[model samples]
Structures are given as structure tokens and as C-alpha cells.
Target chain A: MVKKLRNYIGGSWVDSTATNFTPVVNPATCELLAECPDSPRADVDKAVKAAQEAYEEWRRTPVLSRAQYMYRFKNLLEERFEDLVEVVVKENGKTRDEARGEVRRGIESVDYAVSVPTVMRGYKVEDISSGIDETAERQPMGVFAAITPFNFPMMVPLWFLPTAITCGNTYIVKPSPQTPLSMELVYELLDELDLPEGVVNLVLGGKEASLAVMEHPGIVGVSFVGSTPVAKIVYETCAKHGKRVQAQGGAKNYIAVMPDANMEASVANIMGSAYGCAGQRCLAGSVVVAVGDAYEPLKNELVKRASGLRVGYGLSETTQMGTVISASAKERIESMIQMGVEEGAQPLLDGRGVKVEGFENGTFVGPTILDGVTPEMKVAREEIFGPVLSIMHVPDFDTAVEVINKSRYGNAASLFTSTGKYAREFKYRVNAGNIGINVGVAAATASFPFGGQKESFFGDLHGQGPDAIEFFTDRKILIERWL
Target chain B: MPSLNTFGAILTYAIEMESRLRDYYQAAGSEERARETDKRRSNLERVRRENVTEIKLEPIEGLDEADYALNLDDASAAGQQAAESTAARFYTDTAPKINVREVQRALERCAKQHAENASK
Candidate 1:
């Protein structure tokens, strides 16, 4: 039986006004796991109204009380933690360990939000003038909304929700219609807390629901994570609506392998980063700029490891790489591979038309490695968002940096080397927001903001850490003179 | 609950156990189980308050603050179950050796409650 999911609004499960429902499929087996409401603008308006009504008291609620809710919610999350991992695998098509890792990343955000009192503490100054005092308070913005992507249904929503709610702001989350079922389960966990009605809400739909969130007068801020095209629209719409906005877009992360680096470890890290989550994440390594003499050896080793990766269903404990999100996603990735081949990029390992033994209906895509890729190749420029790694060889470090800086994206970049001076230079000179010396993913922990630069990010303040508190609130200064 | 030789030590450990159980129940899903757990938590709170009052009224001899030190481990389900089981065993082993009649009765009842809750 395909389960039917409802939107959570005003502390209740609400059916959508739209008669049509969208089927949510498990990517691993292409099975319809549930049917999420193709919620219309009316549903969005109702949810926004509920959030607006709840905002008055929620914003006035003591910060400590809000923090207490996060604490309790965190406890509840940890108690049923395995269930979340299961959901991620069942719907998001990530391997078991990868799903667990995503859950841990989400928990880190909650853990950071638990320090709300300390993280959100405002500044105070005395004696600006004789017998004068000034204070600044970090106050909540009325209501906030988040539009997340399909790749990380569990972790990405948390990047916005806990911090926004902990800052005393009511919130509405519109998860990707592709992976809407997990957020429904998450709402059940939040409902267990002692929060007021409509403090947190979920609306499930596609573009119309997103348009509703962006245009809703009650929503004062917007946070989005998705493709660059959609993120640009979200940012522009939020700006037009006169709301605070943070729209983190897609990425084409690159890894530079130096000659002095550890080849074995670098190859292993490249394979994992390129194929992990089936390259669905924004931080997945899509390009590798092997410097000088390292190109031949690195390319050979990478192809060997990429070809050996086990591709099957995410639920299998032995499966190293899972399926792409959907059949369309698989088709898009294969077409991109064909584009690269036609564009003169050497296909060292072609994964086209690959099929698992029994799961023929699955949206599976094996890892593909392309060599002799150039900076001008379409495959190197655009984000394929699949298990395809393009290798572009450079003469030296300077040439590598030059080639990497040519791309329009500046999301994340990494270097594999043993030299301190070179690593320091790369760190200082890289144009990306997140950097790694010997790390593969370069994913920020909860203590720091996870964001990008240039076209990769659309706003000033990012999602996690202290930046989240700033993004969700405004500071008000108070000046007093005693008579 | 080891041979602490003081009513204050017993009360301190018992109070910690009750607090953990309360948190566990607050996160519980079933309405019936939640209500039952809430009642048990209230009973333990009342026992804690009575013991605290007694401690203030008549100071226990040979009592040290160090005896009540706590070691909070991981709060996962298995960890919490182990904690409850350990507390039940502590009360069961220490109740018979207590010289005070009221403290002995409280310890025995607390043991029975923890064991029952843990069995669920």
C-alpha cells in the first residue's frame, strides 16, 4: 500500500486542496513508497496564516524555552535515530553509511542550536557617555520559510529549522516533492515537543507551493537549497517580496592532486567523494585537476577504484554506491556522459547502459571516469550531479589554480599535498567558500557556516552555525540615559 | 546505592534515576505509556522531596557530598535501559542493609518501580 502524506499546519495534519497527488518513489527499486499532496497555493496560504498566528507568541516566548524545545526534540531525534537513516536510504537512495552520516550532520545542527543562549547572545556596552548605557538584542524575525532539495531530505531541512526555531522564529518547510515523505516523519518527532501550535509547519508541493512561500506576506525570511537556476529565482522572488533570503545553489567541486601528495589515499578519497551519494550532494567532487606528473598515475588509480565500486540498492549492506535519484536523473547523467565523449573528453570508464543483476527497474548508474578533459568541456563546466568524474591535467600549481578559477562556480575546492607552504597558499588563494587541504568533501561541521561564493550562494549569511542565528534575526540597539 | 551508609546517598542516586526515567517517558509515543510514566515520575519526585526535607531536618552522620557524584553516560535507548537496570540492582542490593526503616522502605519501592519500568 502506498502511504498518503499530509501537510502539518496549525499543529494538525491537513489534507491538500488539490485533488491530484504526486507519487514519491524509492530510487533504489523504483517503487512508489508514498503519495505526497500536490499542495496548492490555498494550502500554502493556510499554512502561512497558521505560522503568522503562531509567530506573535513564539517570537515573544523566552529564548530559554525555545532552547528547551530544541533539547527535547534533539532527545527524541536520537531515540529514533535509526529510523531516520532507514528513511533516507529508502527514499533518498544513499548507502546505509552515507545515510547515517547525513543524520549525524543534521544532529550536529541541532546540537549547535541547543547552545541558543550562548550563540544568540547580543552585545552590551556601558559608559558611551557619562551615566549612559547601550544594549543590543538579537531579536527574531516574524516568520521564516525553507525550500529544500531532494538529495538530503533529512539533513538539509535541519540546517534551517532548528536554528530558525531556536532563534524564536516560527517556520514553514517545503521539502522537495521528490523526497517529501521523510519530512512528514520528522514532523511527527517535532509534534512530540511542547511547542506552541504552528510554530513549525510543513507544506508539500512543487513550484506553486514555493511561489506561495515566496509571496506570502507573513513570511519575513526565506532559506533555499537547490539548483542555481531555481535558487536565482528564489532569491529574486524573495528580494521582490522584501524578505531576508539565503539561497544556496549547486556546486561543481574540484580536487587538485599534487605530485608530492599521497597517491593511494588521494585516489581512495576521490572515489568515495565522486561516487558517494551517487554524486547527489552539492559538495561532490565533479572535477579533478591532477598537477604535472601526478595526472597519469592518479587517473589510472581512480579508474581502477571507480570501476570496482559495487552498484546496487541502497539497502544492501554490501552496496558501495546506490542509484541516482530517478530515471530522468539517470538519463540526464548518461546523456552528459555522451556529451563529454562527443566533446572529445576521453571516456576511461564508460558506465552507460549498466544494469544490476536483479534490480533492472532501479535507477542505477555506475561510476564513470573521463580523462583528458579540458576547462572548455561542457561536462567540466556544468554540474552533472551524478557519478561522473572528469580529470583535467595541469602543468603546475599555478596553472591548476588558473584552470579551476576559470569556472563560474566557487563552491568548494580541495588540494591533496604534504607541503605546508603549498597548502597554506592554496587555502589563502582559493576563491571557494569552503576549502580542504587533504580532505575530500570539505563539508563544514555545525560550528561553521556551510555555504559558497560567486554563483554558488546568493546571500550574505549562510545556514549553519552563528551565521544561522544572524540570518534568522535582526539586532536592535537600546540606548538609555537615567535622569 | 553501594554501601554508602547514609540516607542522603541513597536519595541522591534515586533522584537521578527518576530524572532519567522522566526524560525517557517524555519522549515516549504511546499515550497510555506516557501517562503511566508520568505518574511514576511524580511518585519519585514526591519521594525525593520527602528525603530532601528529612535531610534538612536531621543531618545524616558520616555523609559526604562526594558520595552522590554522578556519571552520565550516553542517553541512547540501550544506555538508558542499562542505567535503569543498574539503579534497580543498586536499590535491591542496598535496601536490606539499611538501618533506617523509612529509607529502607523507599529504596525497596524505588527498586520495584525501576525494575517494572525497565521490563517494559
Candidate 2:
């Protein structure tokens, strides 16, 4: 018998009112894992109410005090980083190393959030107006909600919630149903910090629970990371309800390889960005637009490197790629490969029939590559969200720019080139939110704002960096007049 | 109150629509030997269409499918076929033998759905 999962609400674990329960399956062996509470409207209401109630005191907590709590949370995360990584690997089907990377990234977010006292500092101007003193600062948005996707359960939530909480606002999180256990553990750690009751809450469900939170009047703002369509719904619905929203959506991230670029370095970067976590990351580079004659050499190198990647359970140290989130994900990746083939793209390395001998039931798709892919092919246009790479050959830099520009998702784009001119032009020409010259993964650090343009993101900005502190807290301008 | 009621109704309808579509796909996939599965799938699709239309009628517009599709016909066809086959395998056999084409089509459908939904 599997242990039943419970929701963390108002500072304690509680049984869900919903009768329907979803079994958390291990993507490794298709084993019956733990069961998570299927949250309903009633549960959402309870969590929201708790968060609302806690916000009053939480927002009033001094900045230094809030910073203290964040430091404690960061310490807790670091101390138990290995444990969290294990849970992520087991529940989310990412490699142990990749899970560790997520843990590190999540901790980094927390660390950044801990610096809220400085990041949230106000700017002051003296005598801007005659005999008037002016100042501007950020304040908490009361009770907020974060709806994070399964790809990076731990890291993505920390991207928003830590800053939200550190800025003295209560939060309710709706983690992905597919990978709820790791988040539940994080919630438990939060509870250990002895924060105010209802300061942080967790509601686990598919769509209904998310809808309830988004529709709730108590939630003043919502920060979401998921597919574009769902992000739009969250953004529009929350906006309609008069809530501030920062919803980051899907990406068809491009990595343009210049003819003069180093093939080995480009291939290495592409390997990590495209195949890491089985290419489930929102920032994962799905499309590689090769310039001029770089296509053949880059394609051969990518295929060779991708083929050598080991696919298995995340716990295995030797495993380079792990099982996908579910069997459905494996099927989806395979279909995209088929589409690539049907669309007349050449398959250099096919991962469709890959089966790990010992773990036959695991949702594992080996690394795959398609050559001579065009912008029209499904593999090139769509976000496969798996360990599959689509290579599009462009005759020149202009064609590469056109191809990257034509993509609907403008989340992140990278250019691997030795020439400064090509890098500068690509940087200026590409329509993505995050850009990289030689770097494959252009994810912004804590200092820079992270978000995309076009259909890749909804709402105004992204979570983390400067934008996160801004998102968690509202800006207020104070003016004084003397007659 | 009207807005709240409309929102509630839309939520219920969306959930119901998702469930029905899932069930229909599952049934169609499972009843591989039976010819009625196709009709069942079609009925479920009709319900999905109606539900989408009804939900969109609310003052607050829900997500549009146009925002999510790369190539609607190809993605949907591939997804539907994959769902049908997976359902068939799940119901009829204990073995986990899956057709590569069916799995691939299903994968494309899923990714397209993600892409479409994310775009919205």
C-alpha cells in the first residue's frame, strides 16, 4: 500500500477534502509510488484563506526579520540539498546530477531572495520639487500564488516564492501534479522554520485547483511558469480579477552556430542544454540553427555526442539522461521524431525504440537528432520538451537571423561564434528575451531580469533577478509638499 | 455574483470536458477491435468542441486553441491516434509493448498541446 500524500495548509499538513486521489508514479520503473491528495475547490479556498490571514502579519514583519527567515530557509535548503535532490530524482525522473543542479539553482534563488533587504531598498531624491522630499520603494503584494511546472519543481518555485516570502508576503503554491513530492518536502522544511501559520501553503491538483487560486479574490498577484497556453489563461484570468501577473511560458530556444565557431565547445554546450533533464526545461535549446558550412560538422558532432548519452534512473551516477516525467512524455517525444521524419528531415540518431534492458517500463527516450530540419517541420517549430534536438541549416547569418526571428517563442536564443560582428548582429537581431553570445543556456542570474517576448511569456516580466523582487513587491512613490 | 457563477460554471465545464475527452480517447484506443470506438471518439470530440464554445461564451474568455497549435490538424491527428493506441494497450494487455509510430504521434500531440497552451 502506498502512503497517501497530504496538502500543507496554514502551517500544517491536512487531508484533502477531495475524494479523488492521484498516485505519484516513479518514472523510472513505472512503479506505484506515493499518492498525492487531489485538491478540490474547498481545499483551495481553505489554503487561500490561510494565506490571506497570514499576509497581514507577514507583510508587517520587519525587513531584517524577513531576511533572517530567508537565511534560515537557505541554510535548511543547503544542509539538506542532497536529500532534496534524491526526492527530485525519484519523483521527477531527472538524473541525480541534474537534480543536484536543480537543487543548487533553487538554493541560489533562495540566496538571492535572502538579499531582499538590499534588493528591495528604496531610492531617495532630495529637493526634486521645490521644498519637497521624494522616495520610492517596493512593498509586499499581500497574499500571492505561484503555479510552477514539473520540469523544475524545486528550482522554479524558489524562483518566485522565496522572493515573495522574503519580501514579507504570504504565498500559496500550486506545484505540478506530476512532481508534487519534492515540493511537499520543501514545504515541510518551510514549516520547520516556524514562520507564521498560513504564511506559505501548498495546493496540489491539476487544472481545477489552479483555477480556484487564480480566481480567488484574496490572491493579489500570481507568478506562473508553464506552457504558454496555460500561462495565458492564468495571466488573463488573474488580470481580469485585478491581480498582478508574471507568467513565463514555453520556449523554442535557438542555438545558432557560426561557421567560425569552435565545434567542440558548441557541441558540449548544446549537449547540456538540449539533453539535460531530457530536454524538459523551459530554457532548453530545442532548435539549433547552423550557419553556412557549420551544419555538417556540427550535426555529426551533436549526433555522436547525443548517441553516447546514457539514459536511466536519476539515481545512477553514470546516467547522463534520465526517464521523462511520464510514459506520455516518452510517447510525445517519439511522435515528434516521427513528425521530423515525415516532414522530410533526416534522422541521424533515432531514440524512438530505446529501451533500457533492466528498466523496460521506465519512460526513457534516448537522445535523438534530426538533420536538414526546416522551420516548417514540427520538430523545429514545436517544443518537444524531450531529449530531442532539431538541426536547421542556414546558408548565412541573415538566414539564421530570419529563422530565429520567425519563431513564435522568444524566450532565449544563443549564438556560438568566434567573430564579434556575427555575435553582435545576432544579439541585436534575435527577438528573444534572454540572449547568449557563446553561452548555450542564457538563463539570467539573480542580478538580471528574466522573461521573454512574443508568445513565450504573458504578463509584464519574469520571476527572479531584479524582476522577481519587483514582482513580489509593488512599487510605491512618496512625495511631501511644504507650503 | 453573475461573474462568479459564470466562472464557476466554466471551471466545471472545462474539467468535465477534459475528463470526457480523456475518457473518449481512452475508450477509442482500448476498443481497437470494436468499430464503435471511433464513433465514441467522435462524440467525445464533439463534446469537447461544444464545451470549448460554451466556456468561451463567458464574459472572461478562456484560452484559444489558435494560441497553442503549430499545425493543428497534424498534431491533433497524431495525438488522437496515439491516445487511442495507448488506451488499447492499457486495457487489453499487461505487457507494455507500444507501437513506435503510435507513441511518436501521441508525443507530438502532447508537445503541440504544451506549445499551444504555452503560447496562449
- Tell me the tens digit of each residue's lDDT in model 2 across B19-75: 544455455463432333334344433332222211011111222222222221323
Q: Give the top-scoring candidate (DockQ).
A: 1
Return the DockQ of model 2: 0.01
Tens digit per residue, CA lDDT, model 2, A1-483: 788888899999999887877878989978777877678989999998999888888888898898898889988887686688789999889876577667777877887987889989989898987899998988887888888899888888888888888898998899988889889889989999999999999998878898988899888898889998888898899999999998888999999998899997678777878887888887788889988899889988888778766677777655668888998888888988998999999888998878887898899888888888988887888889998888888899998999999999999999999999998898888999989887777777655678698888998867778888777788899998778
Clashing residue pairs in candidate 1 are none
For candidate 1, the TM-score is: 0.80
Q: What is the C-alpha lDDT profile of model 1 across A64-114, one tens digit per residue? A: 988998888888877776588789999989876577667767877898998
Candidate that scores best on lDDT: 1
Off by over 4 Å in 1: B1-120
List where candidate 2 sits over 4 angstroms from the true fold.
A128-130, A481-483, B1-120
Cα deviation at A364, candidate 1, in Å, is 0.7
